[model samples]
Target: MSRGSLFQRAPIPEAKFQKTEDVTKERDADGKKRINQYVVGELLGQGTFGRVKLCHDTVTGNRYAMKVFRKQQLMRKKDFQNEGPGRGMSVTTALSKVYNEIEMMESYSCHPRCVNLVEVLEHQDSQKIYVVMTLGEVGSLLTYDECEGTYTAPVPGEWIPASSQSTQCSSRSSTSRGRSLAIPEPIAKCFIKDALEGIAHLHEHGIVHRDIKPDNFFITTQGRVLLGDFTVASKVDEHGRVRGTEGTYSFMPPECCTPTDESQEYSGHDGRAADMWALGVTVWVVLFGSLPFQKANLKELFESIAECQYRIPPDAPVSPEGLHFIQAVLVKDATNRLTAKDALAHPWVSTADFSQLPAYIEAALKVKEERAKKAAEDASVSGSSSFTGILRP
Candidate 1:
């Protein structure tokens, strides 16, 4: 296979790239700072390792989401420890978590329903790793729901500070503005169809997305759903099994959570099947505005999932076809759960009326525009903060 042609390989320059005292500060993009290649905008999302910022490609003038991870913060004490003879710690092995995510993103970049990886840049001097991806202007599916103010907290009486509530609500509107409090069946079908295609591709490649949730599914301005966040994704073995139990508590498959004392014939479950269960929950949320097995606590949630006791609430407006689809995938027996390929062929998706979809899509678009307009108005009153200022001090 020819290199660069098959993939836009990130070149490791012979000469080192350096940064000044301020990681975001620039000094005349001469020869030293390529970080200036992309003009960083607002902070999109953040976590323990780094924050993703809305960015613009100077060359193409296209918008993108840039994740900048400070290498200094990523270093763990265990990374420097010696395990055994001839088995000393390696920096590469230590940071395999980040590298594995990069590899998976690159491999699936071309998949229609998978988020595209634009480029990966390393600023050695600043000890920062920058990952540029196709910006989802509308943001994650969860954000879309949040902006619409339709999502009900799983646990009643959940506390949210009033000071940040407006900011949080407004932030979601700026990105993906669709509020799917109760997404129309046709619109939900479209989202599910695209997501299943992506999941099918991942399974075909022996990858299991341990973390499958609405928050990890992004939407483009065009309303296409893109599966993302591969930090916890793992390649399953030939038997389609993986271990370690990592993912959102609400979305985790029963077997992937705390194992019960009852003895079973099987010691582990197929990772791919676990993903299917999560997909069921995601579909339910898209159609109903909340998770099927949501509970006041993690223990109860796990018990609900383990027993497969969730049902489409009587008040929820899900169609029979949609309920059937969720039932097929949320089976207690992992082996019986529908695969992505199987889910794609289900009636709710494969038999969807394309003509009827446009009306729902148009409705969703209208809701998005209305929400965005309101959010902008709110921002003007609150006074928006700059991206650099938020991160610097």
Candidate 2:
């Protein structure tokens, strides 16, 4: 695809939402109700800053996920910003993330697959900020995968983490429950194809989604995949540079995962290429239900990732096209890896058969069963580890 074609801007559509400038909380008077148009419902989820809730528009009855961030927390985060790059957060950084999310989402709102902001609300008295956006009824893709199938793989006592411990995936630490279960190759291909378009849209606008993972790709009740979460996203500068080692550990690119020492200067990474690397990891997890670098030892895992030492098991039912696509994207050298635009044009994405998706699902189920059996057998052995042999190129 041509750069000009990829960079084309799509217009944001008109929605019945109150503008940020017009939002204000009305103080409650004696036995009187507030004049707010949005009716806050159930608590949806919680984050470091605040919590999100289900909300409804009184006039149109449109549903939205309203994320409210506490001003005190945001300010506290701001006070800690001067410590170092990843040490602390400042109010300026907080506000920049909020505005950046709004701007980036609004820029691609016209695209049906991209998650868009519905409205933004601020309450000075309560010292909070609310972001209203499209609600993903199915929650995160991780939750969806976990709930979709039965856990036939018996849990080993040794694999169970201590109460204070958890498994790390890239930068994010998730409980064992958050571990992946592979989806069908055809379905993965479709989801990836859609996600690639959204990523391409972001790259075209000079924005990089620093954190790209299965959880971030939310699916609506209508079954459309929407790329959400922009708190860590950054816009590329004039030199196409973005600095920082922020993102989930499992989904981060090899370059971003390079450990820094006092003797070496921390060189920033290529934001666009990093996104592509995460995209490759996300696709691998979705299709195989496992990460390539699944070592219990973090040091070895980083070394494996740095060397592009991951295997797509031969017995797994991945098509040649699908395997080729993954190998192409998962290259160690960012300069040689496929970009979002290039990936979209790959035969694995463009020419895959949508009708054979059911067969693909069946194959995935078999692989899941085999994996579970192998896990059970390995657990019965003396001091056996779950690590497998890396695929040699």
Candidate 3:
């Protein structure tokens, strides 16, 4: 295949033509910087190993998300080379965690419904690794609507800090000044289908997205959903033995953390069941704007997830189909948990005909007159309010 125009450059000055070869897409080791010819925009985010920034394709005049990793961080330990058997990340294996994350992101092979890893950039004042990806400005589908005078969209996932959420929400709005809207059911289903397709692709390729969550769930400004941040996924063998307990504690399937006790891995298990659990959680959040389970701390949160101790909030009404699917996927035993495919076929998801619902529901929910009115009332009740204040943003 021919290389994209992005790589075109003037010929080398020295006798290098003899060694001509296609600039193969490559991964990187830390401290070796790969400078992308692309012009980087604002910083999107930072990972333990590096940062993600917006970069412009100078030649094409298009935008892409660029993830830059500090080589200094990666060099202290070998990240990608997870050769030995071990438990938690040691100083020797800390970099390995970052490396595993990069591999997981790249494993998607540029799937439309999964964040694509374009190239790893090396050149910079400081050593960095860049993963180029299509821009997503609308941001998360599970937006938090702070009824407080601020009236700001809540960050998609609770795991992301409030400060981080605020920054992302502000940046996305500055990129385009509109509140991120809840997707239409048709579009929502399409996005879900696209994600399912991506998962199928990964499963076919022997990969699983262990850390599937709303923050990791990104949608383009045009309303397309895709999975991101697969920093904890692992390859699954045919027998299904879970390779490791490598997911967010709350999102992980119980069997994943303790396969021997669960006895669900007749042969083995990967992250599939756990991924479905997270997916179900994602669906619940989309429909009801909250987690089915809540806890004061991480330990309590993990316990709730492991015990399947959750309930649909009485105040927040959800469609019967939606509730049914949530119930099934929230099963504690990984063996009984609904697979993504099965959940896709679930009556609520599959039989859900958003079109058939009252046409007025859209206008009623979208207009948010009640929410707006209530907000103004609350603002009056309070001494100071962001809505009443000078709209600092």
Question: TM-score winner among the candidates?
Answer: 1
TM-score of 3: 0.64
Model 2 residue 302 lDDT score: 81
Q: Write the per-residue lDDT of candidate 3 for residues 126-204, one digit (tens) a residue.
A: 3544556666554444433335311122221232234433543442334322223233333345556556666656655
In candidate 1, stretches whose alpha carbon ends up further than 4 angstroms from where it belongs are 1-36, 76-96, 144-181, 258-267, 353-393
At residue 319, give the lDDT of candidate 2.
59
Off by over 4 Å in 2: 1-18, 21-35, 78-96, 106-109, 144-181, 259-267, 352-393
Provide the overall lDDT of each model, using Cα atoms, as 2-decimal numbers: 0.64, 0.63, 0.53
- Expressed as tens digits, the lDDT of each residue in 300-348 for candidate 1 is 8778877778866644444567778888888887777887878888888
Estimated TM-score for each candidate: 0.72, 0.70, 0.64
Q: By TM-score, highest first, what's the ranking? A: 1, 2, 3
**Alpha-carbon runs more than 4 Å astray in model 3:** 1-35, 75-94, 123-126, 143-190, 257-268, 351-393
Clashes of 2: 9
Better of 1 and 2 by lDDT: 1
